[model samples]
Target: MPKRIMEGKVVSNACDKTVTVLVERRVTDPLYKKVVRRSAKYAAHDPQNICQLGDQVEIQECPRVSKRKSWVVISGGTGKPSEKRIRAGQDAAVEAVDTGKIQPKKAKKADEETVAEKTDDKK
Candidate 1:
């Protein structure tokens, strides 16, 4: 079969040497008379690790690499556009002021003590 190519945005480049790209396509439903959007995630090989999250990318399907990485990044170009997911512990700061229901967890007292000791050691 001929090679298959799809255009999409780079969802993430956090993996050690791989980039996660998400390709979106629009298709019209014959029965419903509506257009639907669909997206598929692919892990692309990124040896340079230069592609940043949100960067648009083009991928070509090839023999399965490992398990989920069947696509290879052809080139790194400007993304015309899109949520992969945030890292496990790092999340964006909330935009609005806290309503008290939610507060940044106070650093535990033990952490504070450690900070104090570190400061003392530096002096």
Candidate 2:
């Protein structure tokens, strides 16, 4: 039989040579006959440390590499282009925020001013 393959997002890549992938699928409920989304996490071997958080990847069944890792990251699958663009955009945003290039807008305290006016009127 051919090895099983699954597509999922890399939720965690903190472990050395291993990443956690969250595979989500829709299944019809047996009793209700309604389609329900379900997800399972699998530990896949990532030898190159290439996968990052939120990276979508393809995992293939292989001989057990560890107690929990029986799958290997085969490819980026359908997530190659989007992943690179997202990561690049995120990195740029982070740098901009960190260097004070993009300052977040602060909300004016109009509510506070109104409360102060009410307190003054009562006094």
Every model's TM-score: 0.58, 0.64
Off by over 4 Å in 2: 77-123
Residues 1-123 of candidate 1: C-alpha lDDT, one tens digit per residue: 899988778888778768988889999999998999988888987766767888867788888877778788877633423233233223433433244545666768999999999999999
TM-score of 2: 0.64
* Maximum-TM-score candidate: 2
Clashing pairs in 1: 56-79
* Cand. 1 Cα-lDDT: 0.74
Each prediction's total of clashing residue pairs, residues at least 3 apart in sequence or on different chains, is: 1, 0
Q: For each candidate, what is the lDDT?
A: 0.74, 0.88
lDDT (10s digit) by residue, model 2, range 42-96 = 9999888888788778899999998999999998734343466679999999999
